[model samples]
Target chain A: MSFPGLPRMTGWRPIATILILAGAVAATARFAFGLGATTNLSDAFPWGLWIGFDFLGIGLAASGFTIVAAVNLFHAKEYEPIVRPAILTAFIGYLLVVLVLIIDLGRPDHFWHPMVMWNPKSVMCEISWCLMLYTTVLSLEFAPIILEKFNIHAPIKWIHAISLPLMIFGVLLSTLHQSSFGSLYLIVPNRLHALWYTPLLPVLFFVSCIASGISMVILESLILSRGGRDYLPTPLRANLAKIIAVTLAVYTVVRLQDLLARGALRELTTLTYYSLAFYAELLIGFVIPFALLLVERIRTSRRGLYAASLMVVVGFAFNRMNTAITGLEQYPTQTYFPSLIEVFIMLGITAVGFSAFSFIVKHFPIFEGAAVAPGLHHTAVAAQANPGFLSPDGGDLEPS
Target chain B: MSQKKAMLIDVTLCVGCNACQGACKEENQLPPSDEKYLSLTAFTALSKYNDLYIRRMCQHCDVPTCVSVCPVGALTKMEAGPVAYDGEKCIGCRYCLQACPFHVPKYEWSSTQPRIQKCKFCASRLAQGRPPACAEACPTGATKFGDRDGLLAEAAGRISAEPTKFVPRIYGRDDVGGTSMLYISPVPFEQLGFDARLGKTPLPMLTMSALSKVPNVLSVGGVMLGGIWWITNRRSEVQAFEATEKKNRPSRHEDNP
Candidate 1:
């Protein structure tokens, strides 16, 4: 299976290969045996670990829109080098989320039912439409990279012509879908813990995803930089980290204000599973990472930057899981823990995502991307991505 | 559709017989079993609360949370006062199961092609102007079937007639925008495990508060983003043009020399 220049399947690749295979086996068992036999899901707890994984994956993958909006739409030319890599990360991340969603759905066969059935009032309905559209937008957003690599200039020019409206639509779709994930929880007020429930959920979710998406981009930069060149400069990485700090600060203020207004501040002090989990989520995901990133020295250093970004990513995962599972645990019913099959299937999906990303990066021109491509060609590809931004900063980044 | 049908179950008039549960199983075509809890097999169940047997089933909410949350419109609130489910339309996301405040909707977890199982308030029977199986087999007139307004009047009459026998509040009358199934118990409702704090407004409204804003967000957000893109790029373009002009002015003099 080894290509001539590609690294041989060795080290972590074998483990990933096995995980993917195991996941396929688990998924097959799940469909054949039914949810009851192969999974711990019950009538009382319909949504379990997979739903939490979807939230984390989508939130992290938000780098797709964030980076595109930054370089193409917002006229941030200095950050252009890492744009292709960030978009690829987001593209793969969303594909995994959609895959897990299919497996988690009881009727995966009827997944397209949302397309035919219209329910404008339903949050899930809106999310489904947005997810499908954004994924298409992301692929179109990513199309030029593949096209440029293959020297398919005709479609590249055509894709370029529509790129401005594409970016706008991409951002709009991501904004709606990401926030709607929080809206899904609004109807469950009686069941969801007070500490997690609030009308500000949509806003909180949108802001936090921006922070996490940036963190993911930074982390990818660091990972790619290892034993090679730094994909992004230290100052650039630090600048992005500063944005994370600002987003986190805003998230903290809004969340605390909402909790206080709901009189759920008391629940924070009363020691229990819900309170303890909420504290951990707040501390790890928001407070610690925010505090660390605020320090100028920490934001600039490789180790400090890596640690803070990783914490933000981990903390974000914890918060989503706490909201999905821990917050709903105290309601009158049996507590849920994902079955082994469930765990393996999730691990499998993750393994496939990593394997696919590395394989694409190895074969493609993601890093040595538009920055070095023929100046006129890339200027047309990237500069015109946002209309007004195009003729100004967009042309200067290229050698005219 | 005509005045919306309702069931008023007065606990004071009933024994703890489980006849309603048995009748419900037969009517829904579920397998015969003395299941003590609600499941795919049991649409309704009798759970003991001290000496009183509290009946549990779908309340068939007027604006059901399950119907509002379903992505595929698999669930619908019928005009005749039943919350209905069409398994074919369901993608089986299980969002309905998560959103139901009463936890009434059950999933057929044992089936390869599972569907949500719950009381549809016997929609077909109500459509035929016949009482639901459970209400018809109540034996003691404990479960009275009539129009919602008629049920409300009967419940108020029972409460006033024997003040000591029934609680003044009808469990479904104004809770979560009123349910087709109403309960009038001798004891306070909360003591028997009713979610008394569901509030006066329908549960779907809570979701709508966020979902309804989507259109405004989409339109305004689109226009605002487009404006920002144009303005920011224009500023950069001006800055870049100025820098190039300064460099070329010095070069022009050197060329003449």
Candidate 2:
């Protein structure tokens, strides 16, 4: 049931469990009370952190699909080692989005209505169908790993046969829904502020999601390496950094071009706060990451890569919030603020997702040889003669 | 092929009283959304130019973004007119909330079972041989509903008859590829809370152009990948063939040996 690089389960379990319990309680309170009773959502702004963080945040986190597609479908095996973990993070992130959405829905019970009673005209209906299909595709794509963990090789060949097709289909579906999310906002031409309003919002959403997805995976991998003491080789980090840098560069250029083409740049000078934020998002999220990764020296350096990834991650978050909340605040008379319970529910949803991911990863053979025993470090000198390249089928678990 | 239904909202004739708002609520059987659901409330835009109480509601866009962008068919425009929503068909994803240009579609963010609600232009009433509650209840005859062409003509007639009394351009006539809900105001629409910069193009048309490029991007990406594969494989094939030919033919190495 063992794979190549699994992490040990001893430390993360208790902390994850506590967070999960707290999250569940918060979710329950949200469902019991109305949205006004829960968080800060107001009339001026209908969507808040839940829409921005859970939906847009997770969408960007799905860069795992792009990387996996490039490596597997395109035969770039250099990215092979990072593929499994990237897929795992994306799957978990999406699962968290669904949880947040359930808590956010005014009538969670009617969630299935979109499926049973289909409306051919609703954008949300399209989004729902696509999200459902995409979720299934992601799970199926990640199934091979799950099966490998279980040593249930009975259907391994069948699963492997479908992997490439599923990946192709997943990319297609993700593209549709990701862009559709922005298209949803295109309806409010008057409501959404001009500075943020562009017919190209959907395109921006699609590009940013790709850039952020890569950023998130890179960040996640570095954290795992530091905390788990796993060998996150410099070469692999360099390769990832290069991908982030290039994509971010493209994203920055396209974003500015969109603004200029729309003739909304005039508003940039008039609206100082939005203009600053617009620049901040582009500079920190895209420009900084691009600059850092462009340098061959910095790409190889762990500290530089980490800092760049962190900025991209934070910048992406701000961008999503700005688009969803601040961008739509031109009509200050109708300002929307999320209620207290809404904030708690959002926090709870995040905690639950994190806890669940930690639990599943710990119990499963996901980390494989990454999980090392405590005493193994002390015996490193003695074990030098036999470098610990764990057997493909079975090996000593390492602490990561 | 068919005539479009339209509403002509004359802001000059509108009184500051909220009779339209009350009448709309009565017809739709909707509770007061307070400030939480601005779109559903049949809002009035208050301005400094004579304090014209402009009735704000769905524009009934020619190409509804909510309909096209919706993954499911939850929001649809009927031939009879008005974009209608089926609550049972809604998955509670707020894409409609995001896509609407006029901010017409409002979400029940507080409800776990939220359905997107907006003015359906009283499609049911239209079918039952009646005008909308707001139009019927307007004491000053500020709001008029009729066939799209008729409304446009009426709007044009008013502007020409009293050139000084109305704005030259008709609001919603060409904005976002023309809306069924038309507006005639003495002051400019921008002063009356209208988005003059929406341009003449439909929102859906803008999105469709970009979406079409997706296929081109994918095909180009495919060709590039395929070309790399061909180069790599071709080089290996040539190398193997040369090695076999050398073994078959008498080589310089063989003569030396």
Candidate 3:
């Protein structure tokens, strides 16, 4: 029998592919004609939906790296099952961010100038250099999985040697650029509305990235399990929930402190949409998820866990957009609803992320118990029966 | 003649006529200010204080924030005290736009291949030792362009001589770590759309404070990762060793076998 998670096609493949192609075409048009030709960006709103969603969206989707590092590198044996898939998701999410950057740039050809002509004073220069370096580091971190697919063994041993340094580098690089993304707006004090403009913006951005990344890991795992993939080990899923629970609690407290420090709490008393959004971001995104994940019963139920994770992810996305767009938009009443082409382009990039992830999982030795169970069956029965639909390697044939 | 230099804008001396705006377009060979490219390079701004025409341009600061943040050195502060741009070197990252505390750098975002467009402080005119177009075209002596030291002393002398006519302070003297272009307003500087919160500190210093943490974060992160890796790898190795030793041991009843 075929694996349940494997694409059965059922005729939906053609439709998905066509939609993705349309998105790619629109994205190309956006780049060729200039941002003004497609996007609704302006001087008041220099960064529009693409930078807001694609960069911040994928950056929050960064849970894959931190989760994998937490489990595998740290030997959190309880988290092992989720590690490989998390890394795969992170790799694709990051690649999409780079793709978005290329499109967003006014002069995409000169994008490489940051590499050779480094300006130490500019945060953008630092962000540019770090992003490129970190992408390389991530690719290296994901190499063992790719190598395993081809049955390559000798170099696999060296993976351990480089893994430690790379993991450290990955975490450091992620922190700086994620924060630097906030620093990009640090100088825009007057233009950026008072609500989002604070000296603590960078710190707030970093904390939110951590909280959102953990939330994303939990969400991805829940979705994968529901899709009837090789099941996530119970222990690993629990560990992810616990991480999300703790991080959310911390994020909530920090966000409140920041608001208080900036004396923004007074503004919340006004019965405006911004005030409502502020409370909603806190309540749904952080408080609710943290409380639910803490309860053992909620964590144990598959659906409950899935719903909580999904809410947190939505909450995180809303929070980032609220700061980047909605908060700033209130100043001059400038409207910036994404055009149709812009929406399609974002959807297309996400499709690419999903497709890349699907291919990687099918080949890699991502699941731990998948290989072991079949071998045990052979020894117990003394029958030369075919291990039905087992991969050719007899073990969970690791892809490399 | 060397390109005319210096735009001495006397905010106190005249009414807000927009002759300078028209002259700047003509001098720079720029098109009329359009809605699509509503940049400060050729845009109009009605001053918040008493509706004075605040013809904004490159301030040419002593410590130019634009110069500091231009990743490719596309924007450089010349020895003659003008901040100049090299379009060929501009990658158009627009950090210079964000970094400029005075909010001077503007972009041609409407174009597919946009370049940063900002006031050059009439560097070309300065090279020719001619008065800048705006100051020259100004019908009143409200605007002047001269040597940096001369301007500062002149500003100081004016403030002392006519304290009642102008505010006690000179704008841009200490704003954003000081700029060559000085402004003497009758009203408060904040009322004129100037950012008063920008302290005596240079903008680049704030960014450097954060970037300095990079090496520290990396070194500490490296050690922590190494420690975790060692523990995980060690545990598995010990487990494997135990398994091999267990298999080699003799059983109590199978000593002869």
Which candidate has the highest DockQ of all? 1
| lDDT winner, 1 or 2 | 1
DockQ of each: 0.62, 0.26, 0.39
Question: Per-residue lDDT tens digits of candidate 1, residues A161-207?
Answer: 77778888889999998998998899988988898988888888999
Model 3: per-residue Cα lDDT over A1-400, one tens digit each: 2344554546656766876898889988887787777877655556667777755655665776676566556655555556666666777888888887777777888877778886787777878887788888777767767776697867655655566566767777887888887776676665565566777777777777776787676666666565576366665677678878887887777777777888877877886767777778777888988899989988877878888887787787777777777776754366567777878888888777776776666656655353211111212222213221233454532222
**Model number 1 iRMSD:** 3.2
For each candidate, give the interface RMSD after superposing the true interface residues on Cα.
3.2, 8.6, 6.6
> How big is the positional error of residue A274 in model 3, measured in Å on the Cα after superposition?
2.5
Clashing pairs in 1: none
| lDDT (10s digit) by residue, model 3, range B56-165 | 66788877778877767788888787888888778766667655776666777778888877767677887887777777878887777777667767888988998988
lDDT of 1 by residue, B118-211 (tens): 9879899988989999999998888889999999988998899989877788899889888988999989999888887789799889888888
Model 3 stretches astray by more than 4 angstroms: A6-15, A152-161, A363-400, B1-8, B32-51, B98-101, B231-257
Could you tell me which 10 consecutive residues in candidate 2 chain B have the lowest summed lDDT?
B39-48
| Candidate 2 structure quality by residue, lDDT tens digits, A61-103 | 5775676666555545455556666677777778778777766
* lDDT leader: 1
